[model samples]
Target: MTAAVRDIWRHPIKAHGRERLAQVDLTVGAALPWDRVWAVAHEAARFDDAAPAWAHCRNFTRAAGSPSLMAIEAEVDEASGRIRLTHPDRPEISIDPADPADAARFIAWAGPITNPDRPQPARLVRAPDQAMTDTDFPSISLINLATHAAVAAEVGQELSPLRWRGNLLLEGLAPWAEMDWPGKRLQIGSAELEVVEPIVRCMATTANPVTGERDADTLGALKRGWGHQICGVYAVVTQAGTIRAGDPIEVRP
Candidate 1:
């Protein structure tokens, strides 16, 4: 098996924005350091707090769902236990995950995505152990940029690589062609994460990462030719360690 570690990212807050990293420390069965560690939940969130379970959907609200959030890019300052959300057009934002005052600021940052009709305020919650991200995986994501390009060729649109929101983006395969990689084990960085699920393409893809415009039929290009509207695979960590961009990947039987 042969593979290469491409890109690494950690989203301190889901759907808000992602922070790229030179390297990340991964623990077996744990998400990369702090990737998708928390997310905002509306007071109207329809789930049982007594028995909370992770939602099995890549449900992110960005400019498509909330335009204001598009301007905020989160950065993790580990030394301060703070995540700073910066924007080109807005005032600099700094929040401490452990402080309630910062939580209020987060609520203010979210307007369109907030459901005011509900009694509880929207708060950022951490991704819990055993929580799967749209599938059964603690922490691992991969996408083949080649696949994105192939899809773009067919659709005649230039899609940015950031649109996929993947932690591992590769550069040498056809569009939506990672389907062939399922059931294989990938050696990324110093860890081995098994490719275990087929990423289900959804409406999120239609939402532009930059302009926040809605582009329908993002999946149309895939269904027309690709066996699946998937450009990547989800992985489960079989081993734990640090991985960085440019690390070689290997497929193991």
Candidate 2:
């Protein structure tokens, strides 16, 4: 069977918003370009700007804690280092996350949507030479559309794949086929990647991207139908190449 790329996505700021791409150039030993490259540290976070380093997800504001964040969509301008964010409940705003001048404005814009009980957003920080992914290591998440369909069917609702926050959405594969792919290599388009492990799901998957509301019980569906709370696999790029939508994914021996 030939699995093909259905969509490509990146979240420039961790758990803040997502951007879809038609094509991207992959680099060896790197996560998807600009994916989770920055994160918003909360007021109670321990991250030090002077000495930025890889910190745990708990240090940032995320969808799992604030479902409203899921409703955000992002558009990034790589050349200008600016990001434009839009949400259903708020006016669109654009800013350069690296600039200190725009930091306060960003926080105020997102403040209303965030959970009042959770630690409020304090600042935006990026560690040099690191992507703020959930995993300490740089990796890309590959999701099987078939498996997503299965989960949606089990839940008796149409779930958006965005809930999973995966980098690559693949189709034409059997449901849950990725579970057996750890330690295997896959060639997609011209890029090669090695499957690392299954992604253990979190509560973030229950939120609806359109409304940013926890309307679905994805965890319950996964546990009841599959006995595990995993929907995708993490992969590390092994070969540098450009990949595009419609690219065929081939299992490499």
Candidate 3:
């Protein structure tokens, strides 16, 4: 099916906030730039601060564990290495998570929204020249708007695309068409990426991005409708190039 990019997004901090983009540059064998570049490790996390590496999602403060986090939005000041975060129930903050003082400030700001039953947000760690995406390999997630619509239809609610937390959002494809993309290449704008696998979703998808509450049973809807709990695909870039919204995407042999 023919499609074009509808939106682009990146999460500088894993599971914490999302930022929209009109254009981005994709590099071969890399995740989207600044996407999940920094991740907040919880107090009980098994992460190495001195030697930061890619740890599992369980080691971080994610929306799945704290639904309130889903409401957070972010904007990055790349030149200043700072990020501005805003939530519905909390005061807006602009801090460089890498700084000791700023990290403390952020931890305090995010403390109330985090799940009190679970480990608390602790240190902000940077991934070494790579992203902290859920996948072991650096991946760019792609979500189909048609598939999202189908899931929304099943749930009997109109859901925000932010629930998927994908890097690329595409439109004009058949519902669930991305499930067939594995092992195929997609030519998007001047970039080409190989589809690796479908992204198995989690409870985080159930939360409402606006209210940060579990308002929908997205996982249940997916299981009931498709017999699977996946809504997006993971892809690794193969060609370095620029891509933007409105650029055509075609499945390649």
- Can you write out model 2's per-residue Cα lDDT over 1-253, one digit (the tens) per residue? 5799999999998998999999999999889999999899999999988899989999999999999999999999999999999999999999999888887788899999999999999888888987999988889999999999999999998899999999999999999999999999999988999999999998889999999999999999999998989899999999999999999999875
User: Which candidate, 1 or 3, would have the higher TM-score against the true structure?
Assistant: 3
Local accuracy of candidate 3 as per-residue lDDT tens digits, 1-253: 4599999999999988999999999999899988999998999899887787888999999999899999999999999999999999999999998799998999899999998999999888877877999999999999999999999999998999899999999998998889899999999989999999999999999999999999999999999998999989999999999999999999987
- What's the residue-level lDDT of 35 in candidate 3? 95
Off by over 4 Å in 3: none
Show model 2 residue runs off by greater than 4 Å: none
lDDT score, candidate 1 = 0.66
